[model samples]
Target chain A: MEKRYLDYIDDVVSRIDTDSQTKNKIKQSLTEHIEALIEKHGSLAYNKLDPVEKVAWEFSENLQLQDRKEYSYPWPRRYPVWRRVSQKKIFNIPLYHITDGYNPETGEFEIARGIFAFGPVALGVFTAGGIALGVFSFAGISAGVLLALGGLSLSALASLGGAAVAGLFAAGGMAVSFGLSIGGFAVGHIAIGGEVFGEYIYKTTTGEGNAVEWFRNYLPYFVKFFQ
Target chain B: MITIEIRKELKSGVIELAILALLVRREMYGYELSQKILDLSSGQIEVKEGTLYPILYRLEERGIITSRWQAPLGRGKPRKYYYVTGKGRQYFAGYRKEWNVVVEFMCKILE
Candidate 1:
């Protein structure tokens, strides 16, 4: 086996510099500006061009595009879309809306909204981000309709996280719900946890408020059958 | 006479204010805003055309302006558009006054 020759020197480390998160925006801006210039002025006018225009005209000449193609997307012109969208009559929406605004890459930010959205701030049917709101959301703090799982989660159905509260069932370190609850500290109609409290609760060791009612209603029938 | 280096530095200094001023008139995308600056200044206020985005991002972070994505003619591909916020309008008005003061003071000495 032959070792491949390396062109550059050792991978250096411990370099210090202020990496402005805006570098990504600059990069994206340059790319679009060049493309736009080429689209507006074909190579025939290359001699009259300057700055980024020269490169754009060169591309236009080389590519032999009589007309520069225009993208529908505005600034931060390109988005990472999962599939090629098909034109429909009834409704239209992208499947995924995600951006890395803080990473100094793609240099853009918007409330990400799609079927599946991921960004610093996101909203969708299903979303994950620092702060999220959707039908089903997962983030540092989230609120969802069906389910929400995060540090602080709230939902209409089942909410699960460090601290969770739901309309129906909830479970976590601190859980509160209406129907059933199970966690370290649970509160619901039927509760089960280390420290549980509710209207009719069955804690780990024994049933508390409604235990006597169950014992009275069923115990006499069982005793008669045995006799 | 302003040297090329000094001219560039001066132009860059007012670039932020220029952006806010124009955006106050109407919403424009990044490229359009850059081109408008070039056209209005007759290519005199030339900075690296690509540098505008970083400035825009910074301005946005400061709540001086805001941005949104909209498709041309409300159909097909989306494009991000920028507009001045209420804070930005007030900002430009106040800053312009300060800039006028600077110009008057500078003229007293340099002239």
Candidate 2:
């Protein structure tokens, strides 16, 4: 019964598009909730159960249907937003505007000033939701002046994602940096990963090598040596 | 009886406000929150995981609420507890005021 419940949870999670951290959180919460329900109802096999059981069954069924139909999982509601601009104004001053549509020929990209904004070429101190170019940007592809984080990110200082390139520090599946890089494949002055090539390289054949731990162990000594 | 479609629509509209209001008093885990909603509404409302999780995620994304995982005391797995933020409280106040005005106007019109 536990296995069945776990299988159902895994199935639903597999279909969702999200980062590993968010996905793990969702899975943990769902597992805990189901465990609580099982404790309350006595058993998952109980014939006459309460609302929780009914809802759990229905949710699993829905996920199965969604899977069969090949429907894309709905975007997670908790996607972080950088800023939110209201009515294209800040304190009655026209601080930003979102273009209705992207026209590369016309060169009209979205210029927004909000806690969260979206556009083709988004420009805000903190922005997201499209080829975001900002101080702290997040998008399908993003370039952050200081810190960039996304599926594919480029930054002047630090970057983290599937593929990241940075002037200073980078961490991802594939990462390149001037100073420190950690990933499955990495290149930098100090590189650590499964396949690494750098001036200072720490390569591991095992894929599960802990890059962060390695960094923690060596960073202080490296800092002192430089100082 | 109202149609399932209409019922779902109604629930969707009010669930966020209900969640925010409940979390105002205390932090709760997902299942606990759902159970409270059912009990408080006298079984008039039932919150499904399918519906509840998305709303929770959305609220968190909007920075209205935050969550942390608490390890179990003995043998069970950890649980994620959610608590409303100050922004959530302010938002709830505005939402409650608007809801009251709308309800009052509707009652007058219906009468």
Candidate 3:
């Protein structure tokens, strides 16, 4: 039964993608959900029972999951306003307006936890840069000026490149979220581990910044060397 | 006469199988499935509107059937069409044989 659940998840993941970093994270999230379900339900959910015996109990008993409304805002107005020039009060003249409000006044998009996971890291980096630039200035060293320049340049480049990479991660994550929503997921609570994992993978791959990972990978002995 | 309780249970199971078998033969939208069942039963088996969706979802969850939402030609509400899987076909084929055996056994007992 465990094997079947895992295989089913593998089937689902194969239907998605393997090359994407966010894809892998979402795949892991789904696998974890499946595992937890089987554990909680005790493998009966996937039991290969006789169809005749199964239908009566399974059909009415199992509740279908309703759609998750993740991000809902009012429907955006499509038509643009145009002001015609008049001889009097030309600047204040109001000309035309169009208003169309269709059904589903609430616009909803499935927001993946992974997609939302970037808010803090980006905030942290931007804040850290502001603090560093605020506290540290060219204290009369030629090298200090060069270091500051390099730091600012790297930070600026990281911000721009990071936004693009973050967009890709968001797209991939959103796809998984959409897939899960379509596939029927109802959760009471979710842990923060998945979010952190997603953010780290997204930032590192997109070249946003990961000073700890860089240090661990490149300067293993430099920890005590600094002392 | 079979008891009403037994008859209802039998009918529900049979109705579910009938729906699956119908999809196996061809893809169908929800309204089409309801109409076909009513037609096949000669108007004896009318399904409640609310009851059918859960059954559809269950079949989808089991991977026996899949649904796609598509807009009709010209403007209209999108309908979900369900198509059968290979596994569904195999399950239904065996189920039909078992049903025949049960019916034959019941006939002999009722005589």
lDDT of 2 at A46: 38
Q: What are the per-residue Cα lDDT tens digits for candidate 2 across A101-198?
A: 23212223335544455665676657676678877888778889998889999999999989999999999999999999989999998887879978
Local error of candidate 1 at residue A62 (angstroms):
32
**Considering lDDT, which of the candidate structures 2 and 3 is the better prediction for this target?**
2
Off by over 4 Å in 2: A15-23, A45-227, B1-8, B72-75
In model 2, residue pairs whose N, Cα or C atoms come closer than 3 Å (at least 3 residues apart or on different chains), thus clashing, are A82-A115, A83-A114, A83-A115, A83-A116, A84-A114, A84-A115, A84-A116, A85-A114
Which run of 10 residues does model 1 chain A get worst, by summed lDDT?
A: A5-14
Which candidate number has the best DockQ? 2
lDDT of 1 by residue, A71-161 (tens): 2223332212211111222235567766433221222345676777777677778888888889999989988999999999999999999
Model 1: chain A TM-score against the true structure: 0.52
DockQ-based CAPRI category assigned to the predicted complex of candidate 1: incorrect
- TM-score list, all predictions: 0.38, 0.45, 0.33
Order the candidates by lDDT, highest first — what do you get? 2, 1, 3
lDDT of 1 at A122: 74
Give the per-residue lDDT digits (tens) of candidate 2, residues B1-111.
Answer: 221222544665588888988899999889888889888877767776766876788789899999998876886667788999999889889989988998899899999
In TM-score terms, which candidate is top? 2
Error of 3 at A17 (Å): 35
Task: Please write out the lDDT profile of model 3 over residues B1-111, one tens digit for every residue.
Answer: 111222444655676688898998889876678668767767777543233545665677798888786667884445567898988788788888988999899999999
Per-residue lDDT, model 2, residue A164, is 94
Decoy 1 TM-score against native: 0.38
